[model samples]
Target chain A: MALTLSPTLSLRKAPSISDEEFRKLRDFIYSKCGIFVDDKRKYLFETRFGPRLNALGAKSFSEYFQILTLSPDKDKELASLFEMVTTNETSLYRDTKQLDGVRASILSKIIKEQRAKGKFELSVWSAGCSSGEEPYTLSILLHEELGPELRKWRIAITGVDLSPAMVAKAKAGVYQEYAFKTTPEDIKKKYFTPVVGGLKVTDSVASLTCFQSMNLNDAAATKRIPKSHLVFCRNVIIYFDEAMKKKVVSSFYDNLLPGGVLILGHSETLHKISAAFKPMMLPGAMAYEKI
Target chain B: MSKVRTEDLKPGLIVSEDVKSPDGRVILPKGGRIEAFHPMLLKGLGVTEVEADSGDDEKLLQAAADYTREFFSYANPDSPVLAELFLYATGLVAQRLATGWVPPTLGERMAQNVEHLSDVLPADEADPEKIVRHETELASFPESSLRLKAELESPKASIGSLTKLIGQDLGLSAKLLKLANSPLYNFAEPVESIQRAVTLIGLREVSTLALGMATINYFQGIPPELVDMKSFWRHSISCGIFAKILSQAMGSGMNPERFFIAGLLHDVGRLIMFKKLPYASTEALLYARENFVPIVAAEAALIGYTHTAVSQYLLASWKFPAMLADLINNHHSPKAAPDPRLAAIIHTADAMSNAVEIGAGRLYVLPDFDDESFALMGLPASGLAKVFADYETQAEQTISAFF
Candidate 1:
């Protein structure tokens, strides 16, 4: 048979990130910003940055990654990059299973133990408080748990974030209805008052919490945070590299009382991080107890 | 006395001890009798559970034991090797039932009320080798997997070449790197590069894992009617997790990943049977369920050979690693392997996965546990709790990573 071949088009439509490009970019991002983008989320890089690459007229993901590393405008681009990934969808009752576990097994147990020692004080540090939903939710839980006896105890719930803007919004104590996606209607009616644009957190819950801007990487700043009986750092450590995770976990360990607990994200574990905290399995979640 | 959630509370439960609110107020005193309204009252105060005598533990355990016995009708649960497994399985069933886990019921048969399934699913004289030969598509392995297999067999293969080969296949590269970072390995840092992943998760181990993933991905067109793909892979991944954990517990110097690979592909022959001989396979499945016999026994009775024999021929024709081939071939009869102890680890792992009901792979009847192989290991049944938990977590991660 005579040679017969069909022609093909070799035009590039959209830039796709090769495996090597993904690895290189993630490594650079982790080293510079402590945000480790693992392989499971590799597709996220392309989806997030594809439009940016087209805007910049970059040829491929490798080219875009090169511009990010070598171009003089890298710092400006990095700012936008961080801004894109950090608009979190934190809600009133995120991870309800873990919250349920805390309410069921942990809170009362701690209260009973504290009463045994004749202490009427409770402290919780909401590391990476992220616009205040977490600390406010926690305050709601504490208020609901303690009921009318709340005034008898000295309660301090400190909420901190790396961004000052987020801290400012958190301190505003205002949220739209979208924030109550998982919140029960009764809880919303009870704990929140309707405002002009949204519902503002009632003062009872707001009074128990204080928000400020603080960097976790800054050890000195972390040290200034009050010692806590419980540290809520869910879904925050995934952004950090190994060294940063160790530093932040060690800081949590140092800031917790002897019998305090540390709760990470529902899926996060302290494996190969430290042996100082003993893992206590609750109903559907795990809490790390300071040894 | 048992811990009852506030939502599940009933009247007439007597409190075992004082139930206190979060503020140190005693909600219910010791020996206090509970009424219907107490559950809601306690829930309002955030009391999630109370220790009360429900007087149903014995009845629940008895029901669970009966369920377990019916579940293992195909296996000799009273055998020396299986008695402890059966007891532990009963406890797990009871625990799950207490937590409102409903057992899956085989609702209705498609070919309703057939007195003899053979009338519907005609018999076939399907030789194992003939079945293997008929499936021509599986013979053409994925290109990346083929190259990796060859590189593994070659003495001159270097890590650089291996990395380059894997990097070319984006799916495999992503899977391998993700697996390296998964809790199964618990690497100290994020594994971002293929080279680092290979180095960290051993050169041979990573290559073998990639091979396994590629092999699994190649069979995408298998009809859903033949099997539920997620359920099948869940069974495979759970078996692999169990094998790896069991190997670690044994402290044997062998590479645990090899056991994982063997367990993962141990059911490859069944997949081939389903693809090549759907009618006979359906007959075997129905026969096993109706007669309360293992699928292997049903296959051997109906088709002259089990899926294990089919797997042996397929792997041999593909020139797979000799040890892996032998492990898959003799999994059903581990006593015949050269290193019966190693083969027995996979055997016991398979049994444990089935006992825990991770996924049935549409094999409703439990497989026969090799008593001789299990007796060779000298492991306590108590240790299996940790193994089962570890397998569950890792299997979930692996499934999510691939699918």
Candidate 2:
């Protein structure tokens, strides 16, 4: 009617997460491969992304998500958004039980089998090593088990992850004391010094572990870590599908030396993916050895 | 309890002055509270970001009380609106607790009071006896399969089913039986059979116990979702506790035990609706937000007839009390209340239950309330504050039994 029609901007209804934006964000995640998003994950998006949308002054997620993909002029914005989304708030020695298993089954077998075979050079790879905790924990295990032999031997503790943000955190070698909650009082005294923000991971433990950004899906990147004597990849692969799990398991198999061990999350089992390894149940955790 | 200072109060608020005159009725007061969010409910409905820390309860209650005062402005006898409202607000509380979810908004409370605001309230010249309807067995009955089943099934069926269905799952069964035999129900030394459970709970209450058993059964097998079964059950038991107290207040003739059962179940349909069509329930909740209708109407529009009707059928099928069925079907519509006294008592208590939450925690900021119907019953809203204090104590004792 070409009559003046001024629109009302807001309604009483709450600003909700849009399904289209949810799917775009979800598909973007699934497209990165090795993941499946279920209904439970819906709230996570709302909690994580909703604030970012409001900050951008976008009325709906559709406008924001479109801006995310189509805004070629906004590449830096895209990268920052991705960095924020993927960063998991976790600490070193996240769960001590699995670390204990690494010490028992993984190190003992490394000593008995690899130790005597003139393969005294034992390499342990900590996958998804957020902020270098797992790799440092690996260093602690080597010091605990191999003792004097730890420094004498070529013990390379390689920490790898996909997130550039996490990789930098790992390289920075700094953490909050809360991050090392499970670190025994003696270990906290030895491995860390309380600083302004949190705790600083000492260079002694820091020197043993090298941090790098490597996507699991990038074959060339993943292949760089060759023949690790022991692999501590606990609690990370839970977000992956069965096929991705098998792929990662096979990758871990390839990365390990013959009879090298693979440690996984407490809730995971390797029986379905690979018959190549036998599960060695430890007192506190479970591990698998290459047959 | 004593009121605290202004500085001790939270920011962002209004207040409703106590407006009830010596003759009893006052218009709506200021500073109304909304409702609580059982955590998952916030996510399901997609409204997580709310006010800071949310503890301004007394301000909210005062607001709700004020809204009531503004709503009627003053009493009008021709207007059964306030009477109907007391009925409806009472209905909402009972239903929400029974369903194990919180009603996101409290438009229902406002609507319950003002739908007939034009109608006059209790007359100053009106005899006190006439104003108070004390007929306990006033609920009507009709020949329907619903009514027949309501009569046949053992009120004890609730206890037996608990033992059977929930018992099949060892953990819950043990918990149910343990609680059933606990001091609350007072089974001399813990009887084993459903008959014993029925006998202990008595015919009047077995239905509610059965519902309790059923709720644990529903939530147990499934993985944890937004519905916190523990908190949900506790809220339902809280409603059950309030219903029991209010039933006693309805004078002697009313079989308050039946009132307790119905009050515990008025919103059982919501659980089924939420479980069956989560998306639909979410939509209905959305509509509830848009229209300011309570959750029941939201449920009815989404799933054709409120859960009250569905629960009525279920109870009827299970052979519960006839009045219990009406209580479920008409719990929210106090004007349609067949047994007005029992209905009013439960209705009032339900509104007050949530209002107390508003008063205690700033979860929902409710307006202050007028006191005519409550005073007629010898229980003003102030008395409700006292009753709630007592309820808080008793609620503690009873919650563990049901949960």
Candidate 3:
């Protein structure tokens, strides 16, 4: 039986991880991913990956890590696990209070300003877009508010993750009603269709967005990417250590065009590392504007 | 150990089992192992496939191509210079023993007489020792060089009736007559022509040595790459030196110098294999690792002969004494050998030289020579150590001139 998780990855039962193999596995990942997750946090990894371990029928954590090392395709599956280990479990318009600020402050300004710009080309990159729900919701919000004008605008909603598996699911572009936790019902009814297994994201949502497997450490490769007018690098940086947070923020700052927008999780900020992004505190919460 | 089945394939190979694609979703239609693997995998990754071949070889040629691919993949493209140095250095040592030096250590009575010329020769005109050392030693002897491969295929003759055949080649005829009269024998001076030399030297010694000498100089034609050509030759010469010194210490009277020469040329087969059949050598190494077989056995199977046999044939054709050539040839097969002295000497010296990182520093796979031979030869461990120490200390200038 699998254990329930609180907006987090979980396994049913913890597998015993020997100190030696754990060190080696940790070292391997640190070398490859540039992420130095402490192996001492046996509880963290075990609790998170237990279900996956049992489900995959791997004898132990070492065996699971060994399987991850088998081939590039298999390694991609591990990368997806790494991405979802902390669970990027945001629902449609999650943190609804902040979503309200996004409507009143950020989105309202962009929609109003685009009329003067003549041809507004908006782009958004939802970094660590696990399972595709967030970007599709953003797509639904844009389509509902902007209508045919949104179609005329060269809009891009790029979702990127290190996990090929999550990226695959993201590309398939389907979700269930559970994904609509903060989404308004009328919006869901208008945007999704009742399908055989789950609610299939409409053709319109899939058409507007592209999902790709990308490593944040490999920023140079994805730097010339979406050329996003807005970025939702929320929740992803929390699991990262300070250095990774600084790095992810710097990459985000480097990628955005001037006079664009950057959003972060409530606890995340650009105060020290990213001085170029000026804070815009609206009624509900804060958003960042590119200088 | 047996050769891994997958690793032995090459182009134009036929296999009994069908191989499936890596995912096992598709079976290659009626396939032999894809012909060449290293090139194939590189190509498969190369093409943004709808699909393609490795252009070097198909995945399955024989059983070994996959192993070959796996080996090259781990091989750094920059090429590890150490491995290159090892091949070159060992080659130089073998080269020097072939023609350059005839050591006091390996000297027979003839060699000993020349070595100790100060005690015996006239000293009024010139220091005979200096003349012997500086002048005669460096003088290149007129010797025929031929591939033992050809000689192995050549017709053999019985000693009693081979004189006519020996009389055909002038150099062979002259060397035989000279050797018959060189006071090397205890018998009366009955030397006249090639036939007399043939009649006296004994069939096994004459034929094998003739083959050994010619074979060595053939290896000399194959140049090796070494930055300090001197050091390279020196290390090989050292292996030879130690082989000789150890042979005497063992009281085997195996003609230490020839054993040294034998030890020096043992790896020449490796060179010949490298130059003539590179993939075969690579496959040999891989199959050895994969199947846990010693690489030599893999080489023997892939090529027609082992390094010992090749070295033997080569030396025999070079007109070396059959005793010396056969000694070297059977160095790895001592118990059955009539002359295990060279085998003991070469095997011990080769191991020591490599152990001390002498010629080719690190071995791909260590040789599985019989250690029991050393005990049977009555050579104590201490005697072996002394020779090894001597080779280690003195191999420098010795290697300089030839390699």
Candidate 4:
């Protein structure tokens, strides 16, 4: 039979955002939380906050912007907006190419260097870890790569997030089925076991990591965290403005030991932000090493 | 797992023993299921018996293999790059067959063809240039598109003017917004307004996209007997997506955006032929299918000029960028173009789209391929599989955006 095109696309129309509405929302969000939404990314304001607008039955982006600026529940709405934009609900083995680069180049070099120094301990930090996926993924990789030799090493992976609720979730060590979308079948089977609400990370895997709630913006609080051989603050830096980025990046640089590495999101670059670290381009990924 | 004779074990039965080749290398592992084709492999191994699971779904396996064999009969399965694709397609077909998917019969297809062709007319002109010249300009080409095209060419053009011009046509604005939001650009921020879309997507990109969509909408009413519109657009969109991806994968510092526009309109000449010379176009299609030749060859044989020629003329008349028109014209013969690498990208993209069974009609005919074009990209042959995989999701979303 001749194929009939589906009508799904035309059935739902995305309410267009006016330039004024976009600027208002962008400025408001930036002023409120310092999450600088670039003018080019005006669409993000619509797409991310679209659900909130629908839930409130707001007619237009302007109406939604008005609610955000004027309503008594504005604080609550802003929090929801923040969560929507800053969502890190990523699956296991997210950014496989970058992770592959880390395993092949960065981790191996760091391990060899540490071994040459006769240091058996390795400390890693997942700043804004978001429910522990990033840190736990690192633990899994380190365990898989190290194998039997892992027992002799003192490995510490600290996962920190600003939201206490997310820290609690990370502490629970449970993940739904969706969490393993990118995870290999053998890895999923070996590292996770079926539990009540979801699959629980195996004890051995869970033992390598810990979760805590600490705001990245707090200078003293960030410094209190241990100095690490590698710092992973991916996808979290997009929420900050230029000044905030420089500040947070400086904090990350200080948090890393000499010759330690820092990794950001694939699209995120230190271009025009800071020039302190030396950038290393790996196959399909990049890492910054502290001088 | 229990011991069973090789003859007794059917497809879908799990193998309990490691079936090995004459060289003693393991071919199938203990947990591997026996496929319909495995019997031949086992016989070649000179093994008469093997251990396997008890139950088997022989009928379902045979049905799947039969469906896949017929579907891909035209493609050369021996090609190293396409071997994985054929296997992937077979597995997918097998899953669908298990889910109660049934192949449509010849009579059903014919009936649908008659319905589609009911409105089709006879050929008007034989010469390609004359056909294009005699054909009137697109009556429905939006005034906004022409204005936007002029603006895009000007050095002093502002994003505000472009946005206002695009905003004049709600359909154009939505298309731009969807394209911007779609995984094509994959921008970190959402594209909400026409202004933002212009600033983010760029003036040339936005203009070419608008022209492409407008042209598609103009030819929407083409008789399905000539070419199913939805399938045609799907093929075109997929080719465009593949071209963009190929350019990116090449990492040769070529502009992928131009490749996308070129690929999207590569088959546009055929659309003209279908509209202006319906019966003749069908003759070419049937000739291609019956003779097992690429459609371009069939069109060239029957009509004396291929669709690319018609497409080039039509695009040039419509004021499309010269480079895009040239790319479309030389897609079937890439090495001859001024920028061979750029033309090679489109050529490879077109073939890849056809190899994966995305086409302008129900009949899937593999396009004539040139290994030199692929070689020009400098990408590993292994990357082809990943390219095909990426094309599926991106094409799916991009096509839906247009509709």
Model 4, span A1-291: residue lDDT tens: 111112321112235577788778777766655566655344434544556788899989888887887999987676666665455455567667678889999999889988898898899999998888888899999999899999989999999986666778898889887667567789889898999988888888888898887767778888988999999987677667779889899999999999999998644567678899998877656788999
**Number of clashing pairs per prediction, in order:** 0, 58, 44, 4
lDDT of 4 by residue, B1-403 (tens): 5666655445556787797776788878888877766766777777767776543444454554445444343333334444444444444554455445666453222222211231122222246676677564434345665676677577877777777777888887788789889988888999998777767767776776766666666677765656667777877888899999988888855667778878888898898788776645754665555433467766754455789888877777778667787789899888878888789888888877775562222454455455666677787766777787677658778878878
Give the alpha carbon lDDT tens digit for every residue of B210-323 in model 2.
444443343344223523355445555556667777766546765555655566666565554444433344444444433333455444433334655555554454445556
Per-model lDDT: 0.73, 0.53, 0.53, 0.70
- TM-score quality measure for candidate 1: 0.50
TM-score of predicted structure 2, chain A: 0.84
lDDT string, candidate 3, B113-157, tens digits: 111011111111112123223322443323433322223334664
Compute DockQ for each candidate against the true complex: 0.00, 0.01, 0.01, 0.00
Instruction: Supply candidate 3's per-residue lDDT for A278.
Output: 85
Top-scoring candidate (lDDT): 1
Off by over 4 Å in 1: A1-291, B1-50, B99-125, B137-139, B358-363
| Candidate 2 wrong stretches, greater than 4 Å | A1-15, A73-87, B1-394, B400-403
Specify the CAPRI tier of model 4. Answer: incorrect
